[model samples]
Target: MYENNLLLERGAARDLPETILLSDFLLDCQVRNFSPRTVQSYKSNLKYFLSRHPIRISPEDLKVFLVHIRDEKGFAQSTVENYFAALSSFNDFLEWEGVIERNVVPQFRKRYLRQYKDQRNEERQLINLEQMRDLIDSAEWICHKAMFVFFAKTGIRRQELIDLDVQDLHVSKRYAVLKPHAKRSNRIVFFDDECAQVLETWLKWRYNRKIRISALFIGVQGSRISRDAVYEAVTEHGLQLGFHNPEGLLNEKFTPHCFRHWFTTWLRRAGCPRAIIQELRGDTRKEAIDIYDHITQDELKEDYLKYIPKLGIKL
Candidate 1:
């Protein structure tokens, strides 16, 4: 029996409603410390699925739903894939809970990536060092300013950024463990002395406030910051630093993810080896593990320092 906890509402029924089951699944995700953004996506997607189908769905119904979503609803391949992923997860949960005897869904997952390869954005957008400095300097809070520096120096995803904790930073070593969130891998990301100084300033403020959260970055409300808040803040400042690009459809300056792209571009321009760049960028480890297996964090930091962003402009 699932307990009334977190977002789950209380009910007086022995048999769990689909609503309660979904709530339980979300709680399970929270227990595993999944990102709030990811949990929200899963809940939204799976609820949409349940609205179309019953608590128990046949393989035929799943295939029909997939076809309807693709042809009638005209959902993009990627959106369909997201729906497929959430439904598959729900199916797995149901099977585990013994609510269903078998696990089968529309094979909406297969070939979605490969078939829509050209449709996706592979653009490697970049911003100049000057613009990077402006975004960092524009941040009002010292903590947000430090976070801006962290993004500019390290090519971590938004998910990975929020996953960061104070313990992850090693000032003496000039490196931080950028733990995996979403598609990223648990890896070391090194920042320069300049970023460290800014971070320490924020740390002093954070320590004085004494917020009881483990998150490295917190909002003015003294709580762990949400991913949407980070995105909005980064975009708000980044837009002032660079011009819009009509060709790419997404200007680097208008997105928090642009920092990661810019970091990769700068690292390559600095002549860091492809393998080292891949490691620092947290590329999909499925193929590059053999190449990076022997590499040490010390060696990586040496390479990281050689071409670290030199923003003379301070926050």
Candidate 2:
């Protein structure tokens, strides 16, 4: 089935060069709408394997590779998971293309990324509603204040915030369009009027200065802000506001995704249904994501308004 790839004789899977097979697998990943990051991971991991191991892979060889990475390389649980995922997908692709007769990757699933202990409870990374307001107050600049407000109120992922454009802010509707990031899934997220006011104020200040950039958020130099800058800004303010875990014992830092989690947790505490919260966060549940389509924006907004605070306007 690798029609465009090297024409290997039937049952001659070992004769196929790993690079050529990897090329075919990568093309398939692209066709299947895998993210560029994922494709790159597959390419790098497979090429690394080829660099170290024989072109022809067997179940026995795969077991050795796994041990080498997990034990010898001292890979963490997540790294081991990622490596095997790459291997599994690559093997599946080759098997599907008839290059291999058996799918051995599945048999190795139990050992791959195996964990012995239950997940450790890291301090609750999210800020409370009061802490959120305090975090916003800790911002030194108008732009930082607006960014803090949006992150706290909107609950969008950091990447979504980075990809945000000025045009995506529908201030009049009190919502922002979160363009698809991971999985190419896009959805609307709502925020309170307090956020709207700050964003509008920022826009006014931004326009008055004649900064022609189209980015929604800009740094001191009037260019689009980098992800690291946003993280540092949040962390810097979070520490000042004393954002610790539930026990309030450790100096836990808040992350961008924390806002998203904070939003869900707050919504749940506010009596919003788990299904609706999942819809807002773009997470699919078994009950069917389409069921949420019946929940109108007006209803969503009304439910959201009941929970988030209506902060006083800050210019």
Question: All models: lDDT?
Answer: 0.76, 0.75
TM-score for all models, in order of appearance: 0.75, 0.76
Give the 10-residue window scoring lowest on summed lDDT in candidate 2. 112-121
Q: How do the residues 77-156 of candidate 2 rate in per-residue lDDT, one tens digit apiece? A: 66767777888898888777677777777676755434422343454475666777777877878889998888777777
> Which stretches of candidate 2 lie above 4 Å from their native place?
1-17, 47-49, 54-76, 116-124, 141-143, 181-186, 208-210, 218-229, 239-253, 288-293, 310-315
RMSD of 1: 6.3
How would you encode candidate 1's per-residue C-alpha lDDT over 22-126 as one tens digit per residue? 998898889878777778999999888888888788867777887889889999776887887788787777766667766675354553334665666656456
Candidate 2: C-alpha lDDT: 0.75
Q: Model 1, which residues run further than 4 Å from truth?
A: 1-17, 20-40, 58-80, 92-106, 109-117, 121-124, 180-184, 208-212, 242-248, 251-253, 284-293
